[model samples]
Target: MVDEMQGERLLATTEAVRLIPMRHSEARSGRRASGDFVPFPVDTTMALAALTRQFADSGKPVEVTFRKLVHWIRSGERSSHYLHPYPGKLLPHIAHFFLANGTYARPDDTVLDPFSGSGTVALETVLSGRTALYAEANPLGRLLTAVKTHPIDTAGVAVALEQVRGSFAKSRARKPPEVVNIQKWYSPAVIAQLVRLRAAIDALDAGHQRDLMLATFSAVARKSSNADPRFSVPVRYRPGDAPARPAPMELFVSHLSANCARLATLGLIDGLGEAIGAGNDARSLKAADGSRLADGSVGMIISSPPYAGAQKYVRASSLSLGWLGLTPASQLRGLEERTIGREHFAKASWGKQHPSGIACADALIAEIAKENPSRATIVAVYLSEMRSALTEAVRVLRPGGHLVLVIGDNTVCGRRFASSEYLREMLEQLGMTVVLSLVDTILTRQLMTRRASTAGIIATESVIVFRKD
Candidate 1:
């Protein structure tokens, strides 16, 4: 081993800051709830620091036994991951950790993510020389994920950018689609730019290039809209607080330039490993079936299922969806109602429904039903849906394949719901055994203090592993 001075060079250098909420941040602008990374709980950070250096210096595929993906609990994403802004996205560092530790997966095996939000897992898998498959329910999410993960040459993206500019200059723009309460979300001028951008993207033939432009358009639309896209749907702004719209072509080109430069680093996955994906529900991955994975073909599954009340994911993307004509505001209500974890139960019922075999969840829900029956119904709806999701995860995984679920625990009327425990019980009923578990300290600023529990807010997330055999 090197002496003290030389050893310092081997460790990853990290900047530490207080985890408290502060001014001059995304939280301050009300544009985001979670702030930048801050080292926290001292011990976890120090332990993770040591493990990260070991993994980094190894330079070979890592074994899961010694992996500490929780290190990324404070590590925000960088590189191609910056192409799109998605709330609650799984960090690329975490995906890289899990894939490296995939001892069950052989060199030629495939990795799958049923809820591949923004394609972090798929991108990491393909880049690491393993094939991957993705199924994301939100169409906008699928578009962003595919564009972020796919690798197109700089020359092709440049040509597509020029074509978009030419289309805008030729005066061939389409009319902006109308929706109910449109003015409340976007100003008339912003709508005009969205329509123009949409027309330009449509000018290109359907391909990755077109999709990438649409993804760029999605980002531009969010910036140009009147809605406060901080946490969830339009956090109604004060009359004078409406955001100013930038010149469409200039804004789009600038975003394209920055993203293209970042993507040059991600490039495309090398070797024969490819990412095959489509917009489809994770509850039913019918879109992912192919000659490669026809019979329980996926060797590994890593995902972060939608957490309860995290955010109305579809509503957050309404700005992106509106520009694409994927869903109108009037119709978006119905669309969100049909998706899991996005539903709002009208006039509660403590209907006594529970996720089958999850006694801990049922018990917690029952306790909440005693205080406020309505909240209990919400609890039941979320966990029952998680059961269906986990069942689907089990179906696609090979008999010996592994499934790693990243989730957080939360509360209902001060009664704690240990999501990891409930999920473990559910996995056991599905013929899987719990293999490993870790509770990573949450380094994010606590945004939902209103939901704080008498047991104190859940300040950690459980990373649970299950193996089907």
Candidate 2:
């Protein structure tokens, strides 16, 4: 039998192991050698024990009884630990623990994600048997979320594909603009066939249309682009790298059919909630000021905000966004504002000056000096938006509700902005108590290395859990 002191030590040791960059096998081996660590049969139990200890150490009061800890550990042990196969998609394994631990639950709860990129949280919430509300400012993002969550009828989708094929055969007489584009990416004959197919899909009734079309469109957007095959984001086109573009019609049909098959396999056709695609600003949130939702209304909040200075989402999705009738020109000027990075600021400065000219140089230098002059301005904007979002979340949540926010840090001009820390401060200022700050290895890695280095960032991110008092 383990005594209390030994148990605490074991929990601490296990948590330390979790923080180490080792595989599960390595952790097990190390634990065995350490002799002070308990051999918990399940990985999640070990993880939970670490998290519980972390919460206690953070000076946040937790009233979880000993029985609850045991139950939580047991529950985690039974839960699946497999990673979702989708690379760009959110990790289901991480989400499951949050859900099971009641991190997003209330007496009566509705989940909301303001920056709901790719709709992972929203979809997961719905799949986990809860209602979710998702709002995204980007149209492409909104469309992707809408398509993923919308239900489909496999049988109807198959019939639609067949019809599209037949229509493509008949429409060979008349060509669509997409056909010309497809010809650049695919063989001429393949392009011709695709054009016909797209026309058929376009002819279909709007009410019965499935997300298969959008998925197909997205698929071809990659295959038929003039951009580098290796690069996911669309960059300036280079010579000889351009593949034969597929005809718009053919590409659309292919995209539709392929996605239909994938959706059918996933068996996610029914019971999906409403997912709207609108050009709303995150700062404004399309809500009246001072509107507070009923307390304890929301169950969870999960999202990945824009990286400090990485991908230009609007430009990257220009082709797809255009196809979906969401042109960047239509979005707000601020929405199109580039992620402020060190380089961007430098470029703005360079644009304003001439070499060796006093006034010209001074004016150019002035613009450069003004670069990121408003760190507080950006923070204020983000905080104001978040406050509105939180107020709504708090109103909707029942007493003792939880909100889980995952945000990475940003670095500008060599200064690190601890975004999560700022968020913690802001939430506390708004009367919420910090609950758990469990750091995931993958997120930590990306913030500290990948995103930071690629975009010249100098900061790291922290995952924060907050509860409304």
Candidate 3:
């Protein structure tokens, strides 16, 4: 009877031990001596402990709550308004979160965005009164960043515009080669006017004056293209015998004027940081990897990397790339050859070729095991490149610096792809801790296809944060 009572007491004690929520420190210190170990934070510990108990009682693991985790990742207070002029490129509310949360605030801090698409983050960094180093592989994206971040003397811009108008009035010539292809997408008169404008801009002497002129010219490129601003594909004017679209030179002028007006509204002309847009690949950034930058050099890193096999950047920016003297064919072929995807992973010794190649192959193989091989290679390659970038970021960042990655999950061949999770894992492996993962409420209509819209649904994007540990 005494032995039986002692055994029952021991069993009861074991059950009670399993029922209690383990403290975070216990888990972190690895002091638990039982099979019922749970990771930190009282809430997480209690929830997980209860889950394990229920699972053990049922003889099965409880169903995973991936949706709940995603919800938790995205939950945050939204911002009310944007401080910059081009709020459309970046959701103002999201940008405000970084500012309010002290993600990009430092008196002597600089920010580096390896994949600075459209200059949203860079502009925000400058608006927050910090220096930003913006780089992009796509010429058009680089140009956009350069133009948006370039400082403008409001008075000087006005005088330059007046001079350009004077030059246009004096010259009466046919559209140049650069503006000729643009003609098919615009009205003849508009094309002629744009040609003259380009000439006038080209004639300007070197300085910020020239940059301002180029900025105006670039702002008109979208209007000069076919309507709808199809970012992923070519600007198709006629669809199988449709009449040629008319150019809206006046509309383009108005757009330029509005941009100038918006600049005036923001009063950003007084103090803007240097915005260099020279074409450089994010994978092989100009800076040396793992080299130490000045302490507290960079405050924040905000960027959106390329989605695997989703956007053929060089092809999408063909017109601009052509003008910038980067051959589209070479770049497209190179990107295709080097990008990660399912097919590349099947080939053995993929990583032996290039550092990115190995990562792409590994990612591809991992996804293939789960039967999602379509773009896994590219996603993997991006992860590898991002790892290199993160190393650079760490080298350049000050202590307690922040890095924000605006990313979206993708689906390939009807299978869900969790690129963000992979990125988080990679960053953590590099000794960075995830600070927060906020879901951005802004919805983008681009990149939605009928396949992705099956059952009329699409996956949302999230803004993930990481701090160097």
Candidate 4:
């Protein structure tokens, strides 16, 4: 069995900030009416950004307590956030606080999320009237982010969904694609139902509408499978005690309908900006015009990066990848190789050992190597890749642009690793000044606490903000 111990790191943290709304009365009044277009809440990102102007002028880094900022409550599931499930989602409120306040980004300015998982930041950026550019290694994630941020005619979606539902009963059962160990994760009967649905979805003309249907199908594929629904990664449930699952077609119809409603709400927003996927690799990103993203062109970046050996993102989405025909069983490992914090590596690469170039990080790697050399290599490679990603991020950010990272610490090799501290150090070395750092306890997130007998709980997270020099 692959060690789950190494790939279970805490991810995506946000600090509580007091929201001092400039137009508090107007913002609050919109929420009172049902179905009214409530603007993004006025919050601390603007307040803090305004407060930091004096320091920005003098070129000094300023730190402040997060709780001292103003506060307000907003719904996290308002837009396309509830479209699909994703591992380690950052709270939408956190993204809204910064994006809406114009602290770092203004209307029509481009904001980037280098590790844009499931489009949380991208959707927020679009809703805030700024163009969003994102880079994601997972094809499924790229599609999810794409569909979530872009708007489609609801009338057309309604018609397409009905056609799909009608065809599900009559469509021919196509052969299921090779998903590794398909029988282990799904019953033969379930596989037949899924393939029929896939065929029905496939009959549609390819476009955003088709993509939306495919995403809904992917969710149904995961939900109706024999894998445990409670866990992030696929794990077969005990045979006798496994909970009964809904039929795949029934689930897809219902899920797609609700998602359509979510999209309708997003469609109502006037002047909603665009979100473009800049390809799979973050270390080398491109713009919508098919050219390399120009240096010093972006106004802001907000992302929650993966933890080294902490997230099994590829494995978790394997079922969807197979169903969507995005990655086949044969190319699974190849897809994983592009991910930043991937756990697997070539056997030959295990013999290589290099210093991460961060002095404190290097000492930690050496300590971890004494316990598990392979694990040490995984950590080292993760840092090296992140260095390249950060280099790219710094290269494209305008001098005064803000970069926000939501990250958490974790235990590896029985030692506590301060991921926030290490990342802050790396950013400092890259000539980015730390403007704010705040830590908050995680109340609840889409995370699995136990992995076999070794994984530890991720209780708190840190939100670090930086400005390019």
- Please give, for residues 167-223, the per-residue lDDT of candidate 4 as tens digits: 887987768997878999888888998999999999899999999999889998998
Error of 2 at 1 (Å): 68
- By lDDT, the best candidate is 4
Query: Which residue pairs collide, candidate 4?
Result: 7-309, 7-310, 9-310, 18-69, 18-70, 18-71, 19-70, 19-71
Whose TM-score is greatest here? 4
**lDDT of candidate 4 at residue 448, scale 0 to 100:** 36
Q: How accurate is candidate 3 locally (lDDT)?
A: 0.50
State, as a TM-score between 0 and 1, how close model 3 is to the true structure: 0.65
The parts of candidate 1 lying over 4 Å away from their true place are: 1-77, 172-174, 178-180, 229-232, 236-245, 287-295, 348-355, 445-458
Question: What lDDT tens digits, residue by residue, belong to model 3 across residues 1-469?
Answer: 1233342232232122112254545332222223342211122334434544664577432343333532221232111011111212444334433543322455346677777766766665554445777766555566566666654555565566556656766766564444224545555665566667666666667776566456556546544665336444455655663344434334334444444543432232223344444236554444334333444466777777666544444455555444333334445545445432212344453333233334543654475445443344445556666667666666666677777776666665555556666676777776787655555443555534234531122345667767875
Instruction: Flag the better candidate by TM-score, 2 or 3.
Output: 3
Q: Candidate 2: where is the Cα deviation over 4 Å?
A: 1-50, 58-89, 106-108, 169-199, 229-232, 236-258, 265-296, 328-384, 443-461
- Residue 316 Cα positional deviation in candidate 3, in Å, after optimal superposition: 2.9
Give the per-residue lDDT digits (tens) of candidate 2, residues 1-469: 2333442333232112111233355332212323222222123445555776878787643333222333323222111111111113344444445544333553135667666656766665554445666766666566666666555675566566556556655774445342213334455564454445446667666643534564455556555555454444454357665655646554454445444433332232133334432224433333223343334445566655554343344445555554444553354234455222112333333333222222332343344346643332333334444555555555554567667766666554345545566556766767888767755434322233233332244233355677777
lDDT of each: 0.65, 0.47, 0.50, 0.76
Candidate 1 lDDT, 1-469, residue by residue in tens: 1233332222112122223333443221111213242211112333434544554576332333222444433344444676877766765655665664426566677888888877888876765567888888777777877787676666777767667767777755656764445677676776776677778788899988788788888787777766665544556677897666567666777677666655554442234257888347776665444333355777888888776654567777777777787787777877776666653677634565744567667777777777776667766887787788888889889988988887777665766667767777888898997665655666443323234443235466666667889
List candidate 4 segments past 4 Å from native.
1-25, 28-35, 43-76, 448-455
Point out the worst 10-residue segment of candidate 3 by lDDT.
78-87
Model 4 Cα shift for residue 415 (angstroms): 0.9
